[model samples]
Target: MSTPAPHAAPLVLVTGASGYIGGRLVPALLDAGFRVRAMARHADRLQDRPWRDRVEVVEADVQDPASLEAALDGVDVAYYLIHAMGGGRSFADRDRQGARSFADASARAGVGRIVYLGGIHPDGEELSTHMASRKEVGDILLAGAVPAVVLRAAVILGSGSASFEIMRHLAERLPVMIAPQWLRNRIQPIAVRDVLHYLVGAARLDGAPNRTFDVGGPDVLTFAELLQAYARAAGLPQRRILTVPVLTPRLASHWIGLVTPVPTGIARPLVESLIHESVAAEADLRALIPAPEGGLTSVDRAIELALARVRELDVATAWHSATPAGAPSSPLPEDPEWSGGIVRGDERQRPVDASPETLWAVLEGIGGRRGWYSWRLGWISRGLMDRLVGGPGLRRGRRHPDKLAVGDALDWWRVERLERGRLLRLRAEMRVPGQAWLELGVQEADDGGSILHQRAIYHPHGLLGDLYWWAVWPFHEIVFGGMQRNIARAAEAAPPDSRRAVNTDTDTDTDTEETA
Candidate 1:
């Protein structure tokens, strides 16, 4: 495929390519006929995307100023989507640093414009750490040397999205929920599809507006109403929600952690963010992005889409880790930390007729939305066990559908290495008595086919870790082997021409039912 002319569809650069919004944004841009260059700290995180080969993936970290120059070079419009919400308490600082550095870099690269998705809130209301950091990022980007466009929204509802999952898990699991009083606070929830539309439309916007716009759906509902609406759509009975005035955000966060798949770090900020009204400040965004044909989504309709993705497992492609994004910017560690410890593992390889790119896509998108490709019930069971023990769990899904980059959280794994068409490795994050790693790869075979390799490495911490490994070894044959074989078959079965087309005509997420 050839690049679009500068005047046609600007060579769009999406930062945070391994993130939820960034992951979904890429396909939207491609379908809209824009040539895209996606930047993430680790390009390997993006390897499994169906459209993996459709766009250029560059390994660059916004926190590292020196790396931005090359990634920003020749970019017509840069989407400043990187934020530190997943980065924890110090996220504000990290977000500020990243945004300032990115803005400065975009200016230096002679980039024509920048677009950022920011947070929305009522004025005069003290914001939470998450909202404050999000707003600051937008502030920095808006002041960029080049013209910038900031689109702000509240409670983005999508299948795998953090905000959506919070209410979703709560509604599904609790027949009666004792939640924070903030659930009563009003909010304007927008569908992920509409958010993408605004973002894509921003590319074709003429001239430098260098301004901020608030965007949201037509309906304004409180958090409780949103939850109730979701319950109705999912066919669940009306849930009883008892709002306790005494539960602070911190308590609510811990309560959420115990009940939902969301971790404490992510839940706290999210809960705190709900303390105030978040209706869009203006309706003028319709002029710029233009409303879609049927108009904005209702909470019920958005809930259906979100729930559908959850059911289909496409939620992983649309979400990211709840852990703070403090993992070193490197995607895959070249070597283990190297402590004197005993290790055990499973290793195997197979060959496939598809191209290396096809196989790599299969390996890249193994977890999160697409699932393990086999024995998913076991995977979900393990993830639940991990969450019970305070591990990262499967809930912290990958950021993008097909992209795997360094630091991205997979179900109980963190993308450790992505060598493009050659290798993809994951470090296990689930609570185990030992440190575990799973590696998958594809390379050219002599006869023109490709070799696929799979391995599970575990370094036992003690007798318990040793026992844990032994207990799980028998299941690896069924889980790991099945996953490998399924991936090969899926890759081979896929049409070479299937990925060439980007379906931007309508935005949708079709996921399977998530394991409880």
Candidate 2:
């Protein structure tokens, strides 16, 4: 079965709708004319998705079978993208049990087809706990009466994808590396675009039930080659990777956790999977879905596109958003006046020629992918320094590029306060010696324009913290001064306040503030 026979959009239910693949998949399915129901345990987290309004969101937990009935009711096809990768050491058992419950419930609901995304099996080699669990879950789905369609793939290349993030950090941070042995092992990788094509195409197939197909990009390369390719795509010099057998998977996983944002639980399984070759033995997936317009994406091309998306801050959803456990609430409660300590500060106030509404719009759109609206090189340097010291750096971009929620993580800062079109306060989370905050205030001026108030407040911990603040004072003026001026200019250059059309980058801003 190649092309799906024509029919009205099926009532499709996608579990783990907030995950990296699932979050991106929802839009693709909608474009293909399918009516989609996105199911996630925490429905609030999915509110930032660009397509959030397009799909129907239902709250469901795999562990609690009772909650899945509504999602399964009247569903024609279900996408089982949920897994326990981040649920700690007991993930395997939980994944297996969850699969059984889902399968049984699907049967009871009279669901027609189950489309599962699983990893390609290692040829005649032992599997890691996560990989083995994936295999077992697929079997569990097929064991039920429903016709299950499984599409197995290896490393998925896309912005905010875990595998690409690991490779990205390795390539960007390390100029030369003492690489693990797995770097020499060969593996097949696939582009997310192609993977979605197959998943959506599978649903249209008139009758390809109970089938398993292998999917991968056209290229088959080693882990070393993949890392080097990413570096080249990012315009860096070809990296030096010296393979060392002494670095075991455990050591490598911990090292990855340090250099990159990937947690030990998720990185460990991926590293363990790298222990075995993951080349797709079968290429029957092409028959099911026609190749993309440009054909399959080569490794270098895939990495290029993925990084471009990151730079543009156009990522749809992140792997971390898959499970929001222990995440800090956005728009944290305001602190007292003496909060982080106002021992010393840099204050800049400018009267913008634009309306208050226009100025605030520019202020609200700061950070995330927009950079600092001033010196990006300095911001990148600070982020890199933070990463080296085991901080989040700027990896966790805003959940939505154009929107900011109360609890959203914005680059190396957290949204401490958001007052819609009036003000935004961001508290620093980088490895600073003490507490710090950046506040932007906009209010209508008596002259019918707007006054922009910018302040940087810091509370030093001790001698070291005080010294750290003064040490960066000279650099701070350059960054902060340029920031206030540029923001004012952007607002001035944009259309009138009522239109809300503003330039994020404009060169005509003039500084009307007294330098302090």
Candidate 3:
């Protein structure tokens, strides 16, 4: 039997167009031959993307129903991807109100259908505040005049996803962790790529409306198992993880904030939601779409893809530095606190069983060969833009493998100074509104381990530099954090080449003593 393709692509209006999932979805829609009208609070935020010109950018908030009439005017389908993840304390109430307002306006606009992505909740189990609120929003959307297609998914594993970031941070920061009881909860994590497929598949779905599909990856594993797998793929040591019943969600959220860049405002609700085992109950989605292509990606392959993408971002910006590496080349002076200026510094020490030489190998291997931590396409496109503005674009790779010297070019950075197994500095060559530097220093532990210090510094020119610095902060967080963890993981996974040197020294000492 042959199925006919749909006549014309619908003009799809996507809310939450500036978000992580929304960012990916809008482009996918465009590539699939749909005419997209994206709505965001600010259009300037959408300017960096390549598709900015291809689609109509309407500046409107979902909460403001009056503003949505224009946005929804000519749209055949609407996708509601907005959530109040960063809203403090009462985000659930805010999310519900916003969804209701949007639903009312969308229905009045005579939209044919509404597609929403919600969280997966077990049938009879108690749902967390986040999951419950997600359900509430879906219910409200379905009550409208238009048909709503709801797709519920578990933890979405991707580069910029909140849940993925939280887990990545915990795995990197804590070597021996005392986790909450929720850590043992089973979860079916779907890749962001897979989730996009289901969302896009629903756009012209034949006859399903006002129906909910519980979607997840094929594999179901406990949170502990996921964490360990992430650690292994990232090259982190096999950590001793213990789950204690004492730590409440609130306390765990605070702990997460301390260890990772996730703020309390966002992590709290997410942590509260961690109590549920969010595996899919129905397998019907597989029947709708074929099996293998729509299934979950293996844990190792997913992490590798993510890491490689991030590295590509960094290398694409080669010769186009963000912050200068190391101390100032001239006598301008350096900012002490992390102000809006370019260079930023953060320090944390972990007890590891590795030598300084092993750690340096990981550092030198960063640029050229190593991938950026997250959002490779975003990095490459931006890097190309930077290069087009007469900045360096992707030509600079390191001079040698596993070796660096002062003033050596590692991508856009010139190695300012190199102390073997101790310190490394890079100076920026990119034409920014200000200057930048990236400095990494190490201290050998008394127990034959090492302390890793990674810092990024930028001296902004004025207002524009400050704006540029803050604008890229989210990306900086993802890229820098991933780099630090990769270094630690690489060091732990490989044995130091100097161990043989140490053994030879011991043998010589014994021979000299016997001769005497």
lDDT assessment of candidate 3:
0.67
Clashes of each: 24, 6, 20
Q: How displaced is residue 156 in candidate 3, in Å?
A: 0.8
Give, for candidate 1, the lowest lDDT window spanning 10 residues. 501-510
- Residue-by-residue lDDT tens digits, candidate 3, 1-516: 112247756788898776667778888899889989988765654654557899999988776778988888867789998776644457788788888888888878888789999998877777777778889999999888888988998877766466766777688778999999888898888877788888888787776478788888767888888888888988989877999999998788767755553445457777877788888888787777664453568666666655555434321111111122122344223634543434444344454456887776666655544433334556556555554443433334443434554444555466665676777777676557787777777778888888888877677778888888888877765667755665676677666643211111111110000000
lDDT of all predictions: 0.76, 0.78, 0.67
**Candidate 2 pairs with clashing backbones:** 4-204, 329-407, 330-406, 330-407, 331-406, 331-407
Q: TM-score, each model?
A: 0.75, 0.71, 0.61
Q: What is the C-alpha lDDT profile of model 2 across 397-456, one tens digit per residue?
A: 666655675445676676666787787888777778877878999989999999999988
Model 1 C-alpha lDDT per residue in residues 132-169, reported as the tens digit of each score:
88887888887768899999988998877778878888
Per-residue lDDT of 201 in model 1:
87
- Name the candidate, 1 or 3, with the larger lDDT value: 1
Off by over 4 Å in 2: 1-7, 324-394, 399-402, 405-516
RMSD in Å for model 3: 16.2
* TM-score, ranked from best to worst: 1, 2, 3
